[model samples]
Target: MVTTTGVLFIVAAVVLFFFWIYGIVSFYFDLRYRFLPAVREHLRDDEQQARPDPEEYL
Candidate 1:
């Protein structure tokens, strides 16, 4: 019984590890392919619109 339990625990651990690795990899690829460009474009637009003009401030 103890051996069976140990084996089951190990199997569960490995399965969870695989899923964790898969999630991390998928997240990274999704961010790189789908999200980064949009984020960068948003930031660029915000920066362009938010620039401070000294004359305006004066």
Candidate 2:
């Protein structure tokens, strides 16, 4: 019974680790392919525009 439990725990740990890795990798590729260019463009626009005063937003 103890051996079985240990094996189950190990399997679960490995599966969870793989899932975490997969999520990080997926997010990186998705951002690189889908969102990075838009983000860069927005940043460039912000830099080109005059800096806004923080009080203006309030």
Q: Best lDDT goes to which candidate?
A: 1
Which tens-of-lDDT digit does each residue in 8-57 have in candidate 1? 99999999999999999999999998999999999999998899877897
Candidate 2 residue runs with Cα over 4 Å from true position: 41-58
TM-score of 2: 0.63
Worst 10 residues of 2 by lDDT: 47-56
lDDT of predicted model 2:
0.93
Clashing residue pair totals per candidate (backbone < 3 A): 0, 0
What is candidate 2's lDDT per residue for 20-55, written digit by digit as tens?
Answer: 999999999999988999899999998868778788
Candidate 2 has which clashing residue pairs, if any? none
